[model samples]
Target: MTASLKRFAATLWQADGRRFPAPLSLLLVGPLVIGLCVAFILPVGRLLAVSVWNPDFTLAEFVHITESPLYLRILGRTFLLGGVVTVLTLVLAYPVAFLMARLSGWRLAVATACVLVPLWTSVLVRSYAWIIILQRNGLLNSILTGLGLTDAPLPLLYNELSVTIAMTHVLLPYMILPIWAALRTIPRDLPLAAQSLGANAVRVFFLVVLPLSLPGVASGVLMVFILSLGFYVTPALVGGPETLMVATLIGQQTTELLNWPFAGALAALLLGITLLLVTVFNRFLGLDKKAAS
Candidate 1:
């Protein structure tokens, strides 16, 4: 069996040449390419087909999506929520990333652990944990009431605020990791040199550090925003009925309504929006150029 396998391998290599042919490379990746087509491309193609396939070709699903005020409102809210979560995560992650980048020894390890440990836990677990913490009689309310901060429990869970907070926590690490990677790449002496040339600390950061870190910022923002847009589990667990997002609506259409065509249309619309946002970000922020450099 081993000798036969060796002979087969030798035949394959020699049949191509000393240097692999383009077709050989394609053959080598053929399984992966086919797998992707089967797994992703075919499903997406089918989805697109179904969106227009209402017994005969039609645009009724898309027409309904556009004409319905509720879906339009939900779409707008999804984008708005994604934007808020991205901004929040960026703001919170930057300080942690900066410290992680600058620290040494055990301190660096500790900071790194703080950023990464939560990621090891399941998203469902994290969302459930937040529910426990933010419920009417939960830990947060207990502490606040105990501290004389409020007479009654504040409405913390089952709202936009709860969803935003949970998502920010869940997505914070993605923002931190990229920004930290960017910060680490920046030479330490650039800031020191700027300071030596009579630049103040704030000015050195603005001119030297912040400018260089924009790549990471852009990357982190893009990632967090996109992920947040598709978020379903976290929002469903923590969010109120009124806190509807595109994903939840899609889920409802797919499972509750059993409306496959409408679901496919919603999914396609979301995919289009995602692509549009990426194009806009790349065009205005130049994320691609910054990443290349």
Candidate 2:
């Protein structure tokens, strides 16, 4: 190995500063490759192994996951929540991202800071903050009651509504940043040129800007959906029993029931679903092609 590496290094220098041999390039990436194997591959391999193995090899855990209505319902709910959150984030983020892309100077800096500061805050803190605002007789309810919007406080906290609101707030930045990046790559001249050609502002945006920014939208959707699927803390704090997700169920299996095999099965199922969605996104939405461009 030492002699081969030496030969590869010598070949790299002989080619001047223009080109590198395959072996030399691989050597440069060796640390990154090893780190990925150690950090990601091994853990995933172990999780897959645990899903199939319970003392001896077995399929019972997976069978339970498939056969149990409770597990199935939670799994479905997790996907549904992820989809809803992704859509909500996209709707809220697009305008902000568009404005950020168009703005410059101190205005752009301030807008960027507004989006990033919340992301820098801890998720736990944000979730708890939502709890304070959404609870009965809390800030929202107090304001509503003062305005005589209703006779009494609304049931806001500890439900699906609160969960959706909090999760959307937490994940909004993920959607905005990618869309902003995609929008930034687009030249301002294209929109102006479209307008000069007699297209209205709305038509110019739809025909030119929106299509150009789809890559970022696709990226943001995929990221938010995946993150929402595995969310634990926010849902736990803000959501009621009716809004239980797969991740929460997995936690219960692992900690409360001491069912490692069942937990592994749940985790594997979630991982499989995530991979399936990514495949669909890449195939249908052309996310990979868009991102590359």
**RMSD for each model, in Å, please?**
3.5, 3.2
Number of the top candidate by lDDT?
A: 1
Judged by lDDT against the true structure, how good is candidate 1? 0.93
lDDT of 2 by residue, 1-293 (tens): 99999976677764567766777788889999999999999987887788898666888889988898988888888898899999999999999999999899999999999999998999999999998998997999999999999889999998888999999999999999999999999998999999999999899989999999999999899999999999998998899677899889888888899988778888998998899989988899988777788
Per-residue error for 203 in candidate 1, Å, reads 0.6
Per-candidate TM equals 0.90, 0.91
What's the TM for model 2? 0.91
Alpha carbon RMSD to native, model 1: 3.5
Write one digit per residue (lDDT tens) for candidate 1, span 1-293.
99999976766665546676566678989999999999999998898788899776889999999999999999999999999999999999998888889999999999899889999999999999999999999999999999999999999999999999999999999999999999999999999999999999899989998999999999999999999999999999999678999999888888899998999999999999899989999999999899999
Best by TM-score: 2
The TM-score, computed over Cα atoms with residue i paired to residue i, of candidate 1 is 0.90
Task: Provide the lowest-lDDT 10-residue window in model 2.
Answer: 8-17
lDDT, each prediction: 0.93, 0.91
